[model samples]
Target: MQSFDPKLDRRRFLIAGAAAAVAVPAIAQDGLIDEPAAGTDPDVVHNISSFRARDWRPHFSSLSGGAILVDTGSRALHFWSSDSSTYRLYPTSVPVSEELTRRGRTEVVRKVVGPSWAPTPSMKKRNPEWPDFVPPGPNNPLGTHALYLGWQYYRIHGTHDTRKIGRPSSNGCIGLYNEHIAQLYELVSPGCQVLLI
Candidate 1:
């Protein structure tokens, strides 16, 4: 029998622990641990990878069905179904100002397909290089659709840049990937209740 070496044992233990930590999240991301709902679109399944681990799973919510809930802190959105137990999760971008993400109840005042973008007065002041108007198209910052909020100036819109999801990169609007927004737009309609928290 060989004598025990404390240093070698500690090194092996650390190596094993580090490997386990990395593997757990990887497995979760691959949809192995958190199986998606049956018949979930492949694109939606792919989009879930962008969400943080804590925000990836579905849970019971007290909010009524047919409601949209935005969790700014987690950079995630949940569209609750009529049953309340089911929801579609999507990652979103956060606003630069915390105040812009005020918590309250609101409704979708309007819905537009291929929305035009006109930088607000404050936005123009902050970025002089920004164009006064951007026509609705691939280049438009609003992407494919927009759900205008009753709170004014705020929206849940799509973005041409997919990488912006799950980041703090928007002025005040919640940004979802173009494909994700297209799917969301079909599910939402004018006057739908929206809760920002």
Candidate 2:
């Protein structure tokens, strides 16, 4: 199996452009970094602000590595060990019990860094008072990490709303927890396979 390292080689990562290239700091390492042990540090959870992507999604090979499939229809998220197989299944934080949770298909097109939160016209139509670009803060609706969805004007981003996880809350975007999105930001590169089935 190919090793997946957080501190992966920058040269090994294929990005869309210079902007995306600088979003995450790809560290160099030989073997995959052991995942943070459960209860490693209550005070040391990696914040979403850690590795932000701006505009890169060319490194991920759709046929390789792990694939994360999120289905809003059932309010569920599934992780495939590999494209050719399925065994490892990880559920999301909350039950996708809201209407905002939905399902569709999209490829990993572009990733962002400290991404600007631009409310969609639809979002603005629903919430005329919503701000354009949410400040890059812990409480920002965009949360800490963000992986821009191929969907037009849509994104799968981190959220400060732990209570909203798995619940349909977004106008049309997929919501991820602060840490999970940050971890994903570190692990996957641009173009990493993503299907919102």
Candidate 3:
């Protein structure tokens, strides 16, 4: 008959627990684990892999008027010039929570350099301490340039906080590094078609 050894059972349990503890954080770091971003709602689970290059053809029928595809899941923005002569992929910061996320077709209705910023009603309500308006400058949330989308309060803009890129950190807009956005601003125009997926 086999003997029950408490010490052996305890040792086995400890080793298994330790292995799981180590593995879980690594998986989360790689974005393979389903978890909410820090300071976000627990219900907002983000399960996204690292950025992978994508073909614009699958997302848009044509690059007419230029095309911008923001893959929220991958936190990457893909841009194609009208003539297909220019293709650029940029890391971006997406909505912090799913509720704030907006998907589907839109277009750049306006292009602004050194754009001013105002907190949306919801944003102001959520963050009462935020300023009512911020003029274009170093502290501006819109960074050096802005592409105002057809959807109100949503923009493909640059951010002063570079750490927000490639993470779920924005309220709803897609944010890029100031330098990258500046480059994109030159490539795109007011009529550029945008798809957030």
Using TM-score as the measure, the top candidate is 3
* Candidate 2 off by > 4 Å: 1-62, 80-102
Q: Provide the RMSD of all predictions against the true structure, rounded to 1 decimal.
A: 9.0, 17.6, 9.6
lDDT of 1 at 48: 41
Better candidate number, 2 or 3, judged by TM-score: 3
Instruction: List the candidate numbers ranked by TM-score, top first.
Output: 3, 1, 2
Against the reference, the lDDT scores of all candidates come to 0.78, 0.57, 0.90
lDDT of 1 at 147: 92
lDDT of 2 by residue, 1-197 (tens): 98867556564455446656565455323222333458664322232322211111232344465555665544444444445444222233332335444455565667665666777786788788878677777657778877776667667777787877755566767777777777666665565566664
As for model 3, its CA RMSD to the true structure in angstroms is 9.6
Estimate, for each residue in 1-197, the C-alpha lDDT of model 3 and write its tens digit.
99999999999999999999999877777865455558965533444555555667778898899999998988889899999988888899999999999999999999999999999999999999999999999999999999999999999999999999989999999999999999999999888999999
Which prediction has more favorable TM-score, 1 or 2? 1
lDDT of 3 at 64: 91
Worst 10 residues of 3 by lDDT: 42-51
